[model samples]
Target chain A: MTTLYHQPLDTASRCVRLTLSEYGISTHLEVEKLWERRRAFLLLNPAASVPVLKTDDDLVLVGAGPISAYLSESREDRGAPLMPVDLAARAEVRRLMDWALVLMEHDVTGVLTHEKALKRSIPADHGGGAPDTAAMRISRDNLTWHLDYLDHLLSTRDWLAGERISLADLAFAAAVSSLDYLGEIAWAERSACKLWYARVKSRPSFTPLLEERVSGVIPPAHYDDPDF
Target chain B: MTTLYHQPLDTASRCVRLTLSEYGISTHLEVEKLWERRRAFLLLNPAASVPVLKTDDDLVLVGAGPISAYLSESREDRGAPLMPVDLAARAEVRRLMDWALVLMEHDVTGVLTHEKALKRSIPADHGGGAPDTAAMRISRDNLTWHLDYLDHLLSTRDWLAGERISLADLAFAAAVSSLDYLGEIAWAERSACKLWYARVKSRPSFTPLLEERVSGVIPPAHYDDPDF
Candidate 1:
């Protein structure tokens, strides 16, 4: 059986989980508090990042991009293809996935993880310092620009990215859901984006993700509510 | 004929150039000053990113991942095959590529681009605005960590990542080269990484990339020297 190492509140982890479920692959989910830096988890992924998938062949895949690519090839028939077959369409999907994962989540999720999660999970030997206010401020400023870009993209497409649902939508939704849980989204300013979120939240694969709870961090009331 | 939309000094653009050359593909290079943000260029890429490829079939492939994927599938011979046929090895290669493009570049090249290139290239639109000191500072702090990680990885391997010289090496060298041009690498502190870079710099495909010069920026004297 395939095993997935992840944390409950990690958006990238949730994205992988949703993809796996969509493909009808039953994975042995291992919840890892990565901040603890357990030796076993480090052995699997030296990068010490979440969402590491250990395949039945004993190959450990790190990062969502690789995981999605590998699974897409392995389980083509079970789910809507995460990447298109046509070269141009595939390129668009990959670009949008990068935009969501690298551009938006890099800063926005970094802020939320450090500000909220890291404080509670940092090990004693790791010199648990307070979240850097300067980094948070920069992240906050960057968020507005990114959100506006998403709003523009959502205005024209039913999904956050390409035609029909792709990994890009799952990636963006996972990040946005995490931010929403932290009450970080400027909802009124991103009305179009919010509407798109409604569509993603309505999916069956997203149900398990929405119900996930992280100890000491209760999600906002609207997080699990599909109508929100 | 294949047409590449690029800027001389752009590292990501250079990565694509090296890959194309290695694959023995002759391309018509159209230099686009990404800093200029022309209307035509924006239409091609709303994210205003560089390294977009237009193929003979009129397919516009954006970003290094998609472009590399397209090229790898299009050709059977020429250069070292960057991606592997084995599913496990392929996953590892893709993971390393993502790490280089998303994680490392986000800190290293992004800082140089925003702090130096953007200010110089978009001065009229960014008139009198203070440089993003926080972003620069975080980048400076985070860079050493990445360098250390690379040094550790390259200690027993010839490449920055994986057994073969894959896209991961190209992506990493491109990001590091951009920073090295800005005098950002602490060579003495990362001897292993420097040694690995010395090997990467010697490839024939890397020659044209190293020789490239941007109008306003002067590269380090050692930038084009393979022995350096």
Candidate 2:
């Protein structure tokens, strides 16, 4: 009975989806058109953002951060815990999660999504027009800087946070997945990051994201290929 | 043995400082001039952000979110938890924390901080200039909207998230305190929000924040007045 209000290309929604799937918690997924700012959605979340989760009894969780925390709290030894139990380890996981989901989204994925995909979806009157090339160029500059950091991390650790796959990996996978959908990632230059991304995408939970197709935007050829 | 790397007017830094004080955890606070992008700071956190907590054992916790979560987890049986023990309640608290620290920050506090405070501190070449009037105006519009939401929430709940004080209130207080210091808030129009601010600022943990001063910028006349 848990229902998730999400969107195809939204990184937060994708992160929640992966978290849900990882916990083996299947819920009805509803695509919320955030641009419309629907009143019902506004009632649920005044922020008018995506990835709002309503539990079976109607308790609502707004924002990816909250929903992720709730799902992790309720996970209860299911599969590998996305967040480690050791407090310090958990802090590390949370740190990378914040980096990928918040910082990366703000600098890289969110900007690319808005300029490349979202602008194409909305009408010109609503401040949507041709993509802002300057913004995209800046995003790429940031993307390279972030990828360098991610590459550095991957070189030292088995995964983003530590040895086993954690929510940090999933969050980065979600953000990168959306960018991949828009054909934004330059995989060849970043072999280490690419390998790590491949491992993350190979997860069964990432299948839906790989298969997702936004009408006007076609993904890069290697986007859905786990080996690539 | 513990130390906090922070900047006086930084919202995230203020939030963490308040949380640490509330939990009765004292740390030697060090002012990190973020504009300088200190190499030593970068070694600790590549993100080069403030509010990085270095633990007694040399564990560096970056970002306010992780620091808050880590403190809460270690706060077993401490003074009324800043985050509730109940999972659902924790989710609501997280939601509001995200609202205040992230959403409200991106739209309001962060904007004003950059335009007014941060800009004044940095060199003109470092993207600093006379305060962007258009950006300030937009931030004010967003600030009003956020205050309205806070007013509505306060009207129903005893605190921001629920019946008790939590990190959500502290986070909001941090953001608003910075704005108030800049003399940006229109206190008369938003009576409910003002009252809530008054309550939050009245907490003992808020003393350091009120006493904080930057070299050139001056806080409003009523900035430190608890009853005002």
**Highest TM-score model number:** 2
| Per-residue lDDT of candidate 2, residues A1-228 (tens digit) | 999999888888999999999888889999887878899999999999888999998999998888888888877556448888888998999998888888999999999999998888887877788999999999989998998999999999989999888888888889888988888888879899888888888989989889888878888888889998
Model 1: per-residue Cα lDDT at residue B95: 80
The Cα local distance difference test for each model comes to: 0.78, 0.89
State the DockQ, from 0 to 1, for candidate 2.
0.87
> Pick by DockQ: which candidate is best?
2
Any runs in candidate 1 off by more than 4 Å, and if so which? A76-80, A116-148, A154-156, A160-163, A184-195, B7-9, B28-36, B76-80, B112-145, B160-163, B183-195
Shift of residue B34 alpha carbon in model 2, Å: 1.3
The ten-residue window of minimal lDDT in model 1 chain B covers B121-130
